[model samples]
Target: MASISFWTTGNSGGSLTVRSTAGLRGLVEAAGFTEVEDAESPAEGRQVSDFAESGPRSMVDLVRGTGAPAVLVSFLDSDVGFVEAVTPGGGTWEALLNRAVADDYGIPLDRFPVEPAVKEALAWAAAAGLTPDEDLLLQALTGSAAFAEELSSLLLVALGLPDPS
Candidate 1:
């Protein structure tokens, strides 16, 4: 069994405790989703901290070092499972991030990073696989015509898909 915990970051507001894998699965179960992973041999060293850094290997290093099977379930871009899971058959990262920002912060994408908002949103969304490409930060700040396209493209390229099949 692999355990996980989620931490949320906010602009000025700081961090919030989200949930642990045990808690998440319990929620999922409560919501009618079955727990699929065996809890007997859970992944070790579960640290539900603030989120990973902004690079490819750094992300892998952080996740792998956590000893989480969710890491294996979360690999993106270079990982074939992520590609195949998210490519044509899955949800969109942009949609998830937009929803998160709108639903959680009451802020639109254009209004993000209103002063350290980037640190919170980027790190938060990126960690959640809701916004993957670090490259999005540049175009988003510019509000360029390419912003939408680049964001979408980055969302497509960088998201980590959940492949249960």
Candidate 2:
């Protein structure tokens, strides 16, 4: 089974713990990735949280330091950013996401689907008076418990894994 570690940004309230987090964990598991609790020390299974104050580079470093395939899910109100940690065999996550968007929505990488998605989602959230948190954006998009599942499914399809319902 392929292993994938998940990390999230912008958890201000100490609420979005990746391991026991409500929405993402189930989706990741459903997508068939064996979740590695501690990518830094795989055997230790330690819980890790990258603070918003640490910036994106810290998250990038954390992901790269893992030496294994990993996904860093950022919840900030940016252009639907998906970055890949440089691992031995895995290709760029940006390329993967672009291709997935192209395949699913016919929006090529050059067109940049993430920007529009983020814009639309944020606009909807703002109109609804929702906070621009990860959970809200995710819930706005996938209706709770489906964000990671949906994203993982897209990524799995990009990686040629069997699509999970």
Candidate 3:
């Protein structure tokens, strides 16, 4: 009954939440990890004050406290850099994007209308001195299978699980 929680940033400012949980579960199963359905929204009943004070840390703590793994998926923006502070170092949004585009991952960048949005987001992150990548951004825009698999693998590694499939 192992579980993982997926959280995405950059949705509060009119951006969309990247709903990749289903895809992640499939990839995890394909990779030989047990899959657990998230039957409820983890954010349910969370106080605004809790989120306001702790931000993504609260979500991580909540998920981990439930005896499950937590995966924070961040969209590119100035505030998105906060993911680096909460998670282990060097797991930058940019690094995730690069991995998604690498061999085997093969994100079809041209298949989705993600270029315009990603360009805007990258510019925003750069302006804030953050080197955010476009992988999650593309996923948020298109939810392509390649991006989904890339994201699932990233989360699996972050959760200290094997990702061979």
Candidate 4:
């Protein structure tokens, strides 16, 4: 199966500004990742980590630098799955799949509200010339589909991201 964890924000309309290999390099570099490189599948619209080298703090900084809403999906392993969305207005929301693991580890899953993130995604969709239903965004952000990568792919398509395959 094709699967990986990464963050993606919308692209400028009708352009590859933020969804192409070059674009991702630029975005990450702009976000202060000095030694950025294409992900294993650059067409997947993700840049491999400076986050791993620099720490999670770098990832947080990268998202904040976007100045726009962004979504992150992590499904690197069977026992761990996470999704997060951040709005331009500063709202952040997340869902933890693999609840069983979270329970086992005693991790708190609910950290913020979902509605605001959905609203932000809607607003972003409008700005990007895409129109996905609110319920779809809601479900995508919060649903427990069998696989996190599957859900991530669905959300990307719904938000009108180019099919990275």
Report every candidate's CA lDDT. 0.27, 0.31, 0.30, 0.47
Rank order by lDDT, top first? 4, 2, 3, 1
lDDT tens digits, residues 20-98, model 3? 2343333322323222232232232211110111232433343333322233333332122112212222122322333
Best by lDDT: 4
Model 1 residue pairs with clashes: 1-41, 1-42, 4-21
lDDT of 1 by residue, 95-131 (tens): 2222232333333434223334334334544454454
Question: In candidate 2, where is summed lDDT lowest over 10 consecutive residues?
Answer: 12-21
User: Which ranges in model 4 have alpha carbons more than 4 Å from their true place?
Assistant: 1-23, 29-70, 76-80, 84-105
| TM-score of each prediction | 0.23, 0.30, 0.24, 0.53
Worst 10 residues of 3 by lDDT: 45-54
Model 2 TM: 0.30
| Per-residue C-alpha lDDT of model 2 across residues 60-146, encoded as one tens digit per residue | 343334433333433322223233322224332231122332234333345333444444434433432334454433332332222
Q: Against the true structure, whose TM-score is highest? A: 4
In order of listing, the candidates' clash counts read: 3, 0, 1, 0
Ranking by TM-score: 4, 2, 3, 1
Each candidate's root-mean-square deviation in Å?
Answer: 15.0, 15.2, 15.5, 8.6
Quick one: how many clashes does candidate 2 have?
0
Better of 3 and 4 by lDDT: 4
